[model samples]
Target: MNQLELLKKFTIIVADTSEINSICKYKPQDATTNPSLILKAVELKENRKFLNKAVEYAKKNGGSKKNQLTNASDKILVDLGIEILKYIPGYISSEVDARLSFNTEECILKAKKIIQMYEEQGISRKRVLIKLAATWECIKAAEELKKDNIFCNLTLLFSFAQARACAESNVFLISPFVGRIYDWYVSKNLISTFSYNEDPGVTSVCKIYNFYKKHNYKTIIMGASFRNIQQILLLSGCDRLTISPVLLKELELNNTVFNRKLIPPTIFLEPPRPLTEDEFRWEHNQDEMAVQKLSEGIRNFGKDQLLLEQIISKLI
Candidate 1:
């Protein structure tokens, strides 16, 4: 079996793209999309139909231009998500706006709206994992949404504090961005790269994995934002791995065999870390790389969201 085939034995392969066609090509178990991916999908010729439909949707559901654009943006993400769901048998992670990352109330309201859109399309809310940035407020938002049976995937995760908060909140899944973590370290030190065993991103995920396994936290760990096939290989037994198409194609082509690198450690009873709101902030604040990357990630996604609105503006 090729590496991709073998890797599936360990990790649930999730296609990390807004391109529905690629999801079919990869045959991933799940698919994830953010503003950046959705923006790219909006420009694709094949996905133009969804964009046009969203414009018509905005027209019919008339509101202020800002609200219209916001609604249309949400519409297209779900439209793409709805289409991608047809190919993958598992969940589709549709993100809450990064701009709303710090607003607990808004995050809860937005998540409900996204779930409602999927339900209206005859898709079950159970099939959607509402994605939110791993800000303290967003985590609290997820805690509330969970009571309503709306599961979430907390992304932009960087530090142990973020992971602990998600676990205590009982989030459905947490996507610790692997490659972005590695990138921050490399930029700081001006290094080319680290080997898979020593890679900072890989180590970060492993630390969380061991901690969760030791504590028996049931939240799923889906490693995301891989920079290379080796990073994918290193995280072989993650609950899931959200891989970009470029890296997915690379894994498909490489016939090299690999072994599962992440296995849940045996339970060793210890005090569970249910980080308080202040503790979460302080602990996360201390990690310079996490702080910077988390902020940078939210800004980039927020920018892409605006750019997506611009596309909607021109089309409408």
Candidate 2:
């Protein structure tokens, strides 16, 4: 079996793309999208129809310019998610606006709105996972949403503090970004040596996975932002791995036999106590890499979201 086929035996392969064509090509079980990916997709000539439809819907609703743009943006986000859903048999993670990352109330309201949009089109909430940044407020928002049966995927997770808090909040899943963490270490020249197994990104996910499994937490650990196939291979037994098409293609072509690198340890380790809001903040603050990346990720996603609105404005 090719590496992709073998990997599937131990992990659910999720296509991490905004392009419908890429998801269809890879045939992953699930798919994920963010503002950045959606922005890229909206710029594509083939995806212009979707953008036009969103603009039209927003115009018909007849609201203020800001409301129209906001409505149009949400419409397009759900519309693209609905389109992508047709190609995948599993859930599609539609992210909330990154600008709301720090606002729990806004995050919950937006998540409900997205879910309602999908429901209006005959799609059930089970097929949708609201993607939120792993801010404490967002996690609290997710906690409330979970009570209402809305599932969440916490993204932009960079440290164990974030992971622990996410698990404690009973999030549906947490995406501990592998490649982003690796990128930070590399950029800082902090690592004197590197290997797939020793890659900071790989190590981060492993630690999260072990912690989750040790406590038997139901919250899934889906490793995201892979820098290469090796990182993907290193995390073969993670709850799930959302892979970009580039790495997916490489795995499909390489006929290498690889074993699962991560498995729940038979012995449970001592579980850490749940963190308070202040503790969570201080712990996150202490991890310079996590603090920098989390801030950067939100800023970058928020910027793309604005850029996407610019494209929609032209259509309007």
Candidate 3:
């Protein structure tokens, strides 16, 4: 089997794009979008109509631009998300604001608001996975949202500790960043970072993947933020992976053989022990890498969100 086929055994491939057509081409089981992807889509000449309609909806439902509409950006964001979902067969992960990552109540409220908007558009809760940062507050919100039967995709994950906490919480999915991890290693080592399979980011994901498989945790592991094909191949057996279009096209062109590298049955020998909020906190505090990555991920997402807001301002 080709590498993609091999990866499919243990991984559910997810496209990371706002272009519904691009996602259709790869036949990924699911798809993911963020403010950055949506921003990129709005800039594309072909998606102008999508952007325009969202703006129109905002005007009608969001009131005037001078008097900001509560959750207006989220409304538009979800509208665009619904459009993207039309082309895929699986769930779409829509993220909450990075700024709200620290507020459990606010996160829950925003999540409910988004889910309501989706329902208004005839989208079922099952088809939507609310994405949130893997902070303590976000986890708390996720737990509450779960009780309401709303699934969640815990994102900005960088450490085994973060993965452990997410698993303990029984989140629907956890997106462990692969590319950002690679970036860290290279930034720290410069040119030497180009070495073959020794990428630290790839190793990090493997560790987390094995941990999840060993414990047989229900929380699905979805690796995200890939930098190159090498990282993707290294994580062929991960539960799911969100790949950018650029990388997706590269995989199609190469047609490399993919095989399941992670066998949970082979690796996990102990019973699963879930972590508590305090246990998660202590573990995260000890994981310097997770702390650094979580902070960096938030900052990066926050900057992109600001840029997206600026773009929306110009459009309106």
The estimated TM-scores of all candidates read 0.97, 0.98, 0.90
Q: Rank the candidates by lDDT, best first.
A: 2, 1, 3
Model 3 CA lDDT for position 156: 89
lDDT of each: 0.91, 0.93, 0.80
Tell me the RMSD of model 1 versus the true structure: 1.3
Residue 199 alpha-carbon offset, candidate 1, angstroms: 0.6
lDDT tens digits, residue span 232-264, model 1: 899899899999999999999999987888887
Deviation of model 3 at 120, angstroms: 0.6
| Model 3 worst lDDT window (10 residues) | 63-72
| Candidate 3 positional error at 295, Å | 1.4
Deviation (Å) of 16 in candidate 2: 0.5
Q: Top lDDT: which candidate number?
A: 2
Query: Arrange candidates by TM-score, highest first: which order?
Result: 2, 1, 3
51-162: candidate 2 lDDT, tens digit per residue: 9899999999987988889999999899999999999999999999999999999999999999999999999999999999999999999999999999999999998999
State candidate 2's TM-score: 0.98
- Tens digit per residue, CA lDDT, model 3, 2-69: 55565667778999887877877888888888767766877888877765665566677655674343
